[model samples]
Target: MKRNNWLSLLEGKYRVEIISLCVIIVIWGLLADFVVKELYKLPGPISVFYAFYKVREVIPLDIAVSLLHFSMGLAAGAVVGITIGGLMGWFRVIDRAIDPLIEIVRAIPPIAWIPFAIMWLKLTHYSAGFIVFLGAVFPILVNTYAGFRGVDKVYIDAAKVLGCDKGKDLIKYVAIPHSIPYTAAGTRIAIGIGWMCVVAAEMLGASNAGLGYRLWSRFYLLHMMDRLVAYMIIIGLIALIMDRIFRYFVEGKILKWKKGTVAV
Candidate 1:
């Protein structure tokens, strides 16, 4: 029975993932060994495995610093984006007046702000966080605004009929809940972009320590291919972990009501 259960488990999608991953690793190893032919240029999976051991001592600190930077920026972006986006969406005049400016600013890439961040914040963790903020804020703001704008007329009318006539009351009772999904989607997107920005922010010398700093300075610049690949893998893994956590809390718990409407 135990063997049968194990075979059944191996018949699931998890099995496919495991098989595909093994195939990919084999292909990567072959490419590194036959095509690259240089450890400094393209180290294989086995090489990256050993490299992880070398970085074990510093990996925790690097992860913490990167997370700190990401957290500061994500928190600030959520607050500012949601607040401004809410006001703009709730009031047409505010939207018209501020939207053009926002559009113009949004056209500028997050990397472009690196120079200003360095100058203004002066190469501290704050500067790194600021770059992350630039990456995260606009997606959240745009999505939140869309959510508020998309609140149905019928919902508003019904709320008003229920004696929730005040702007604050309508917003609190109807609009906020309606906008939660949009805001959640934007936050997920921002988390991805923000994580990417963390690497860029640290890579460009915005901070002295972090995954990006080590990935660039200690590995890439030093031509340590195995270590660099390890860092890249670590970054991807961390992002996946964070995304799962967000989905669990936001979609699984807070938005559990949506399960009926969604495929889940």
Candidate 2:
């Protein structure tokens, strides 16, 4: 009876998800099989599955390289964004001095920096990471600034009464905690953008070995539509997995206080 109850619970929770996935797969399969008769255009699930086997030897390395680029960029972006954003938030003079420069730089698309990245850093992981950084840094900076700016004056006064007199101390204790949600939101956006930038960076000659590189150079150039589609699907799945993991940690652990609230 207990086992039956558990099974029912699982089914109830996942029924919609399961049904949606099945429906999507069925429609995709039908479209590939009937409407898109040409394999080059749409290769269906079976072809994509087989393509994974065809490129199984290199998928791990590609994934690792892509992740390396992602980590490098994200780490650097987060640090710089938070530091600068904190300073800007804590001081009006700093904000005025830096705001115009930041706005001008961020106006340029990350892809536009590829030439400079390759020229300055060469075809290396750092160059790829640089592109990812451009894609990620702005959102985090903006969101963190907004978060810090939104901190209540009452909280600052209370902190001051509690002996948090120094600017750094007040920011560390009062502002940082209040801004966590905003920072988290920015980081989430950065993750998606950074992931995409890493792929684009790799494809556009930032690195010689990555999912994007292989997908564009090996699969697409050779007209291996199945393999190309397979890589695309893999990229999407990895992004989805990353987002879910981040959400789990942030919502389940870091922001546990928000549970049972509308924000959760």
Candidate 3:
């Protein structure tokens, strides 16, 4: 009975994802082994797995370095973005005064700032973190601003009627709660962008010890295509894990109230 129950639970919860992953692996293996005759162009699953095992010892250090860069940049960007965005949304005058400058800055691509970051901080962890921060901040700022602005006037009025007319009270009780979904969405986007930026920054010599550094070293210097593919797969797996962790904590637990509104 216990085994049956566990099997049913897996079928209900993870069936689609499991099937999709299997299909993707099968297709990838078939194409790499048969269709793509050029082994260097696309290594088969077996080659990639062998490479993974070969580099298993160094994986932890690379993962740690990359995670440190990602976490530092993401935390800083979230705090600054959310604060500025919240204030701008709450105050029309502030928004008007700051919007033009923000728009001008946002027009520049995050990667474009790499030169400036290198000049300012040199090719160090801080430079990499700065690049990741640039990648993460804008999406969070825009989404947070939009979320706060979209808060209904009716809710504000209700708060006022309940003697919560103070700005802080209204924002704390009404605006913040209403904007949680938007913030969560922004955070999700920020994480993806930040991860990409970390890799890019590392590739550009922002760090000497990271997954990106190893990936570039394997591809360019060592000419190890199989190990390069292994690094790429590891990066993807790390991102997937981070995304799932965020969703489980933020969406699944904090936003439990939203469950009733959607059909599972």
**Looking at candidate 1, what is the lDDT of residue 198?**
96
TM-score of each: 0.94, 0.93, 0.89
lDDT of 1 by residue, 1-264 (tens): 457876786688799887888899999999999998989878999999999998899999999999999999999999999999988889999999999999999999898888889899996889999989989999899999998999999999999999997999999999899888888888999999999999999998888899999999888988988999999999999999998888888877778877632113
The lDDT per prediction is 0.91, 0.89, 0.86
User: In model 1, which regions exceed 4 Å deviation?
Assistant: 1-13, 260-264
Full ranking by TM-score? 1, 2, 3
TM-score of 2: 0.93
Count clashing residue pairs in model 2: 0
- Candidate 1 lDDT at 156 equals 97
Candidate maximizing TM-score: 1
lDDT of 2 at 198: 94
lDDT of 2 at 186: 89
Q: Tens-digit lDDT track for model 3 on 1-264? A: 457864675577788887787789899999998899666888888888899999999999999999988988999999988988888998999999999999998888888888888889986788889988988988889888988999999999999999996899999999998887787788889999999999988887777778988898656477788889999989999999988888778867778877522111
